[model samples]
Target chain A: MRQIKLKERPDGMPSAKTFQYENVDVPSRNRDEVLLKTLYLSVDPYMRGRMSTGPSYAAPFKVGEPLNGGIVAQVMESETEELKEGDIVTGALPWQEYIVADPNQLRRPEVHGAPVSSALGVLGMPGLTAYFGMYHIGEPKEGETVVVSAAAGAVGSIAGQLAKKRGARVVGIVGSQSKGDYIVNKLGFDEAVNYKEENVSEALKTKCPDGIDVYFENVGGEISDAVWPLLNTFARVPLCGAIAAYNLSAGESDIGLRVQMPFIKSRVKMQGFIVGDFSEHFREAYEVLSPLVKNGELHFEETIHEGFDKVPDAFLGLFSGENVGKQLVKVVEPEQ
Target chain B: MRQIKLKERPDGMPSAKTFQYENVDVPSRNRDEVLLKTLYLSVDPYMRGRMSTGPSYAAPFKVGEPLNGGIVAQVMESETEELKEGDIVTGALPWQEYIVADPNQLRRPEVHGAPVSSALGVLGMPGLTAYFGMYHIGEPKEGETVVVSAAAGAVGSIAGQLAKKRGARVVGIVGSQSKGDYIVNKLGFDEAVNYKEENVSEALKTKCPDGIDVYFENVGGEISDAVWPLLNTFARVPLCGAIAAYNLSAGESDIGLRVQMPFIKSRVKMQGFIVGDFSEHFREAYEVLSPLVKNGELHFEETIHEGFDKVPDAFLGLFSGENVGKQLVKVVEPEQ
Candidate 1:
């Protein structure tokens, strides 16, 4: 078996050297446990927070420990009736090729007709994130303008589509022209602004002539500064992530325009949240999102890298806008 | 009649030059109109927004136009049966000694047994601001920690008291020692941090050892910077005013520590609002607050300027933290 561990905490931007690959023997399973082989692993921008020693929603990943996150695996052998051998399951697991896991810790992904890897993206945490944030916080009304930053990414793509479904005039802000084109053409966003090419503020002003009623904030900093001034009265901002500030060096404050004056003038509501906050209502979310995925009404994209060795690069690529959508690593071929 | 007009838009902070005192003829009343004698007029921090020719919740005060705000007055003459000649009333009106108004624009304050001047402080717009912003937005739970900035000012004072009444541990951040004493000793706050005397961030950490669950944001800038880092998960911030940045010069951005990362990490919800946003529910707020004031359970302070000529000074005193509780200008005695 093979495993990857955190070699050292990065000072700012992480590098390939931050992860250390190790060879280990597969551990035996106990009663009610299953021996599983890793199939796919998810690499998310939020994992950057867990890598740091600072306080966050989730506990920091311990130094010199195997990095763990959402993983899809196939049960090679099962000792319990809950799951059978060759059954596919998904849950949070260690970065190992083959390992022992309790059957209770994982569940069969309800992917419907979508790819099994969709369990790591649209049918999983990212899907639920978009569902809760857009519906519960953003609450885009019909004909209202909704702006989504990092629109081609896992969460934003789904969120923008959801807003469009709600009859909102959805405008996406992306880092590249291709991502912008993809969101507008394939994802059905009303408009797209490439922050890297166009002046986000001016472009947004032109596209969202009535002002933004809902701002789905993902990549913060300059992008957010551009969105603040254009928010309409009673605008709702669902602060999902700040990937732009994830790699700031120690003591470097994430400085930008103040939100007080604009917020007060517009009577805007900005709320920061994570997907787990709405775990109790996840069934409600899946009931809605699963059908959309199955019916091909909800579109999603995945940028998958081959082999477990590519996981670090896949994760680091998130900050540089290298991935069009969900970034994942395929560990091995499933035996099911 | 005497009126004060906006002489010119102030580049930054307004001075005596910003106001023009003029003599004008008293206008005649029409059908459903009343001639009111201004008794007391409010000088609020939010008025600074109106003074600028910029987009705000309320329309900007046009150059050469008389500034208008919440005023307490007595009807000298009436053409409708809705109000009598001696009836006391309060409404948003011009900064004039005597003016003609439609009865539809004014309402008699239900002051219970409190003074008529209380109509402009604890029973008027400021009071409603604290009521909604505290109850609807802050929603501080028992034993939770609530921090209020500009604690001695009108909105902050009332908001802090409201949090205390909710059985939360209340900590107030004030500019002066006297203001701090007023919030802590007089207003029943658990502790007060004098931003001018002590390190605000450090003092808050000491006082709110459990972490801040609700923050009543009255002043922005450094005071807000201190509160963000100390907020607990699911904390709520009711942003009512930002006096600290009201006088910011043109093209000067109101810069501070970025809120994105902190807000996301803590899942904080910050909402900016005015009293009018909750106008439909003003009766509900009054039902709860009027008795608190009449029973003396809700203590209030006033820094009343004696003459109409003192209005500009009274309004400017808000930015300098010279006044405690509500600041009002007494124009004249009621001509009943």
Candidate 2:
């Protein structure tokens, strides 16, 4: 079996050397455990926080331990009555070729007429994050402007489309022209700004003439600064991630927001969250989002890495703004 | 009659030069207007946002116009049936000795044993801000550690005392030793840290050994940098003010929180709010807060400025971190 481990913590930006790939013997399943081969691994921006030894909402990965992620795997062997061979499941598995999971931790795929990889993106955590972040926290009203950063990324693309279906005026902020165009023309955003080219604040001023009412914040940093001035009274900001400032080394200071005072003065609500924190809302989110996906009213994009060996490279690309849509690694062949 | 107008737009921190104290004839009351003799003026931190030309939750004060604030006044003449001569009321009135007001715009105080000045601090907006900002946003659970910045100030003090009343561990962060001692020894905060003297992070680490579950933010900037590292998972931050950053002049470079990305990883909920947004919760807040105050379960202190002429000087002191508790401007003589 092949696994990826945290070799050393990166100072600023992570590189290939930050992760160590190892070949290991696959462990046998105990009494109630099922041995499985990982078919796909989810590569998300949130993993950056796990690399640091700071006080994170989640625990940091110890150096030399195999990096863990949400993985879709097929059961190769079962040691209990509940599971059988060739059954596909999803669970928190490592960045490895195979994993042994308790059946209680395994969730059978819920998607119909869609690739299993959907279980990692729109049908899974990323999709639910967008759903709960917007609906529960954002409470977006009809005809209100909803702004989203990382517009073409896994979570954002879904968030924008969901906002659109709810009759909100959706504006997307992306890093590239292609991503911007995709969100506007293909994904149904009212307008999209390429932050790499145009000034985000200026574009936002033009697009959201009345001001942004809901901000689904996936990328924090300069983009956050731009969005602050445009927030209207009672604006809701659902802070999903801050991929922009993840890798600051010693000597490099953290970029702080000068707009914090304005947040209080403007009565804006900025809430930071993780998908795990909103699990209770999953069933409701699925009830709403599942139909949108089936009716083609909601669409998602994926930047797929070919195999398990490419997981580290895929994750490292997140900080550099390389991947488009939800990033994932195909770890094994699908069963017939 | 006297009125205070904006002489000029402030360059950075507001000074006396920005205000013009002029003697103008008091306008006559219309058929529906009541003549008011100003007795007290409420000066608040949010007024700083109005001083700027930048967009705020409320419209910025126009240059060359009279500065408006919440004021307590006695009805000198009444043209409306609802208000009579000698009746005391409070509402948004300009900074002046006498003025004409529409009776519909005033709310009569239900002042029983409490002083009318309490309406300006502990029983009014600042008090409401602390009440709702804590209950609605912070959502402090029993036994949770609550950390509040600007602990000696109006809203912060009330927030700290409220947290303690709710059975949570409260730690206050202040700028001076005296203010720290007053809060811990007198007002009953479990602990207090003078952010200016000691290493804040170390102090917070020691005081909040279990980690900060709720952070009532009043002073942002460097103080927030230290507090960010000590927050616990599912922590709630009610960001009520960022008084530290209000003095930045034009063309000042951005000072972003470089390490704030952990908010996402830790799943911390940081929300900013203005008091009026939760108007529906005001009665509910008063229902809970009033009994605490009447029973002396909630302790409060006020830093009263001697006269209305001292309003500009009192406001300037706020930027310098000079106040010990709630800051108020006395528009008339205290009861003999």
Candidate 3:
């Protein structure tokens, strides 16, 4: 079994040097454990937060231990009656090609005859994060303008789509023209502003004719600077992520006190949240998001990298804005 | 009758040149308007936002118009059946010596036989602001540490007291040592950090032994910088005022984007609100706060700038941190 390890923590924009590749013998299943062979691995922006030693929603990665995140694997051997051999399960697990997981910790997500890779992207943590942030936090009213930063990425795309489902005029902020087209045309967003192409502030003013009422803030930085002044009175901002600050030098500001005045002046309610904080509502999120995803009412995309060795590249590409949607690695093919 | 008019839109802070005092003939009361003799007028941090041009909860003051705010006035003549002559009423009224007021626009606050000026201080806008922000927004639980900025000022003092009433260990951040002493010694706050004298962040780390669960943010500058990182998981911030940012040059960032990472990592909730936004529940706020004032359960202080002409100076002194409590201009004494 092959796994990835954190060799060194990067100061900014993690590179290949931060990771170490290792090989280990596939372990046998224990009484409560299910021996699994990895089928797909998910690399996420939040993993960057786990790299540094600081206060965070999740614990930081131990330097010599195997780095782990969302994984979809097929059960190779099972001692528990809950899961059987050939059954596929998904959850936060180690980055190894094969590993043992407790049956209770993994979920057998119903893919509704869809591809198993969907479990790591559209039907997994990314999907749940978007769903909870949109419905429970953003709470967009019909016909109100809803803006989402990181609009081409996993959570942002789904959040914007769900906002549209709730009858909001959804405008997306993306890094490239192609991604803008993908969100606007393919994902059914009302508008998409290419942040690299045009001045986002002026573009937002034009697109969101009615000032933004709910801002699903994922990539906070200049995008936030543009959205701040345009927020309508009593706007609600579900602060989900700040990918822009993940690579900043220590002591540097991300979306800092700049928001304080705007928040005060407009009576804005900005709530920061992690998906785990809303774990009690995960079943509800799946019930709501699964149907739309299955019925093609909610569109999702993914940028796939082949092989387990490509995991570090997938994570590094996130900072450089390489992926259009959920970035995942195809570790190995699942048996039909 | 004399009134204060906004002379010009200020570039940063309003000076004597931005204000014009006008003398007008005292007019007879209209059938629906009661003739009012202003007794006390409030000068608040929020009024500074009204001085500039931008998107604010309250409309910006139009140049050449009378500057108005929460006022305690004596009815000189009854034009409607709603009010009688000599009745002390409170409302948002012009900063004028004598003016006409609509019965519907004024409130007859219950002061429990306390001074009428209490309507503009402890029992009026500032009091209600602190009351609602603390209860509805901060929602500090018993034994949790609650920190308030601008702690000796009108809103902060009342907020800290209410937090204490809720059984939270209350800590205050004040701009001066004397104000710090006033809050800790007289008001019975658990601790007070003099921001101007000591390292605020370190002071907060020491004073708030359990970390902060609720932060009543009124100043929003260095005080916020100190308060942000100390916020515990799921900490609630009732963003009531930004007095520190009231006089910054246009486009200058005050309390800018430095809070983003801390806010996100801690899953904090920072909600901004004007007192008037809770106007529907004003009666409830008064109901809850009035008895406390009457029973001496809620201690309050006021810095009285005597005479109607002192209203401008009183308003300006707020930016300089000159007041210990609610700053009010005593325009005239109530009728005997």
Candidate 4:
């Protein structure tokens, strides 16, 4: 089986030279283990953070080890009673086409008649991250305007929808004009700012006339500067991810502290959270989100790349805003 | 009577040129008011924010208008039964030798057997600010290492003592060696870092070996850069003031955005708050803090600028780090 491994850490934006594709031996499954055959794997922007050696919520990807990510797989063989042959599961699986995994660590995702890839996108970690970050941290109230950056990405798309359901006027900041239209028309955002073409601050002032009450900060460059000064008093900012600055070298720094005055003046409460921060509430999140996603009350989009070797390219594409929504690599077709 | 007026808006550091001293006739009191003679007028770092025409927690002081701030005054003539002659009160009184104010708008501070000037320092706004910001926002737990910047100042001094009282190890960052010595030797801080002498981040790494669990962010700029990276996962930061950035022109921007990565990687919760945000809880803060001051469990310092005419000088001195603890202009002699 072919697997992707880290060849060298990139200084700035990562390139194809940073990854190595190699054939690996398939490991044998022991007691309480299941041999998983990779089907669909998730490609997220946050994975870029794991490539560097720094203080991160998730451990860094080691130089000679196969890259690990969210993967939906079918159980080829089971040595434990918890999972059996042909059972489907998802978790932090390796990039290889096949591997042995503990049944305890794998999740039995509820597909609910949708594509099995939904197990890695909407009903999985990204969806759950949006649920807790928006509800617990942002706490969007009726008539409040909510602004989210990278609105076309996995977490931001789901977060914008959840904020709308809570009676907030959602405004999204996207990298391209089409993605802006996608979020505003297809995903129900009240307004969308094309960060590429428009004067972001001026656009926010015109769109968010009531002032931004809840800012779901996903991208953290010039987009953040445009959002902060417009925040109303007692505004809440849930710091989800900063795909904009994730690729900057370790020694590089930006002008983020300029917002401290605005933060204090507005009495802002900003928190940076990981999905693992709410680990105990995972089931609670699933119970609420799974139904909305299945019934179409909540909407999601996925951009899929075919074949196993497209994983690294799919991930790198996230930085340039090439993907429309939840970017995933389709490895195999599930059996009927 | 003498009053201080804002002559002009400052570009960087405020100076005597920005303030105009003028003589004004003491105005008559209303039916529900009391004529007040200033005893001790407070000069705080937060006033720096009010001098500029920008978004701030408090309204900006208009050019050619009298400046206003906290003052301990004695009732000279009472037009209401609620206040009588000789009754001492404190509130947001104008920066003048005398004024007329409503009894309801003033605070009849509970002295708890300490000097009446304590009403302007530990028994008043700065004390209450530290109390709520540390307890409610920072949430310093026992055995945790707490760090407070601008340690020898009024708010930071009390905040450090409060953290020590909570059984946490405290590290202080101060401007000079004397202020550094004052906090560690006199105020019981576990360690002190001189931002002027040593490298701040390296100093924090050496002193806060366990990593900072709670950071009372009183000063922004490079000092903030030092404290943020050293924060532990799920750490709390209470944003009090930004004296360092207060002097920077409204148009100037700093490299504050660099902290976002560290903030997210550590799962940090940083909130900016004014003491007035918790107005209903003032009595609760007083009930806990007053006894600590009377019993000498908590110690405080004051830099007294000698006369009512010295008010503007005292206010101006704050940006240069003139005060050791609370900077107060002694407006008049106490009752003999």
Best candidate according to TM-score? 1
Candidate 1's displacement at residue A61, Å, is 0.8
- Model 2, B106-177: lDDT tens digits are 987543335455455555556566666676678888999999987766667777877876789999987778
Report model 2's TM-score to 2 decimal places. Answer: 0.73
Q: What is each candidate's DockQ, to 2 decimals? A: 0.07, 0.06, 0.06, 0.07
Q: What value does DockQ give for candidate 1?
A: 0.07
The fnat of each candidate, in order, is: 0.14, 0.11, 0.13, 0.13
Tell me how candidate 3 scores on lDDT.
0.66
Those runs of model 3 whose alpha carbons end farther than 4 Å from true positions after fitting are: A251-336, B255-336
Would you list the clashing residue pairs of candidate 1? none
Interface RMSD, one decimal, each candidate:
35.3, 34.6, 35.5, 35.4
Off by over 4 Å in 1: A257-336, B257-336
Which docking class does model 4 fall in? Answer: incorrect
Model 3, position B213: C-alpha lDDT score: 84
Docking class of 3: incorrect
The window of 10 residues in a row where model 3 chain A has the poorest summed lDDT is A327-336
Task: Give the deviation of candidate 1 from the true structure as CA RMSD.
Answer: 26.0
- Per-residue lDDT tens digits for candidate 2, residues A1-336, read 667788998777666666777888998778789988776665555566677776444579889998886777887888688888887788777777778889999888664434455566555566566666676567788999999987776677777877886889999988777767777777778999888899888989999998888888765668877876667655677766665556556667546433232233233343433223344544443454334334543222334565433433543343233433234443333221
